[model samples]
Target: MSESRSGYILLGLSALLAFSYLMAGWGLPVEYPGTVALKASGILLLAVYAARRNAYLLAMALALSAIGDAMLALGPSRMTLGIASFGLAHILYAWIFLRVLRLRGMRGGMGYAMAGLLAVFGVAILIWLQPGMGELRVPATIYNGIIMVMAIIACLSKARWLAVIGALLFVASDSLIALDLFKDYDPAWRGPAVWISYVAAQFCLTLGLIRERP
Candidate 1:
């Protein structure tokens, strides 16, 4: 296989490991070691694919994500730290998406239309269920709205199906997690779906990056 393909395969493996670790209830401390390995490996592979563009930025984003994962697994005591890490990761992702959008040029009205629709749906659902959401309702709703916008913006930047799907899946995964936080859900099933979708989203996104013109 070509080196590019090999890099994707390695990234896929790293994502798989992350999913497995989450499923096993390894928590932050136990999961940190494995996540560190996976993230480092993923960064290395992506570095090979980087050619004088936004590669370093992408690597930094993944590294931030890894740190967030570790903080989350470590336990509840580090919730603030975990949120901070993940927040930075999201910012990094936003930057990368912005770069991609600039390179591809902004899409016209259709893109904005799609984003507006997503926002409407997201906000409507949140509003309808606000009472049930309690403390998490507002924050979850706001975050989802931002992410949906980001997803749409990311999609508009490129025609790659992988990138679009990845962005959508990310929205789905986070939405599920928010629902779980606010309401009662079957943890056994919900947990796996969330992590699996999360991993898939990341894989699709990174793959899209690798496929971009250097």
Candidate 2:
């Protein structure tokens, strides 16, 4: 089969796994050993696709995301490691958006305003979660700030709507996780919501960056 055909197949398989995982719940208690692989499989598939397409940076980021998923699924003890993996992934994503993909000319005042708004949003979120962060406060703050910077860079990419949307979805997904983890707002829908948004975000970011002029 051609790369296109294979890519689609991988994506289909990923969607299937994501759907199955959702149906089975997040498998929070490690129902089985396969649970970790099942949780990570979707993004791992995407990482494979990215690697095949020669998007090494994107592949690395996706691979890290898969690892993060697996680590988080293992238990609460691995949460810090999971967050660190994701933080590094976001840093890679920001680099890709700012350097690799050329979207549009950055506007002067508008650019500064947009970045300022994102910074404010990140700080606000950090403040809200500060009370509950306790020992994780500094890590959470750094992660939050990095993700927001990633989103800001994506937005300033101007015409690259795919990257912008992906970054925002990623931010939204992380925000839900923060609420579920740090705040007193752990809704039943939070798990599925985070996974769905995160999957879509990664898909968009990968596809967008891969399509950019190399």
Give me candidate 1's TM-score against the actual structure.
0.73
Put down candidate 1 lDDT per residue, 139-186, tens digits, no spaces: 455555557667767766754668667777877887776666555555
Candidate 2 residues 1-214, lDDT tens each?
9989998998899888877777667444446667788889998998998898888998999999999999999998998899999999999999888874354566457667877887888888888889999888888888898899898887776636677789889999999999978886877788889889988898888778876545
The alpha-carbon deviation from the true structure for residue 206 of candidate 2, after best TM-score superposition, in angstroms, is 1.4
Candidate 1 whole-model C-alpha lDDT, 0 to 1: 0.64
Off by over 4 Å in 1: 1-9, 22-54, 107-110, 125-142, 211-214
Error of 1 at 117 (Å): 2.8
What is the TM-score of each predicted model, taking all chains together? 0.73, 0.91
* Native-to-model Cα distance after best TM-score fit, residue 118 in candidate 1, in Å: 1.9
Error of 1 at 214 (Å): 5.9
Estimate the lDDT of model 2. Answer: 0.84
**Which residue runs of candidate 2 sit more than 4 Å off their true CA positions?**
26-30, 100-104, 107-114
**Which candidate ranks first by TM-score, i.e. highest?**
2
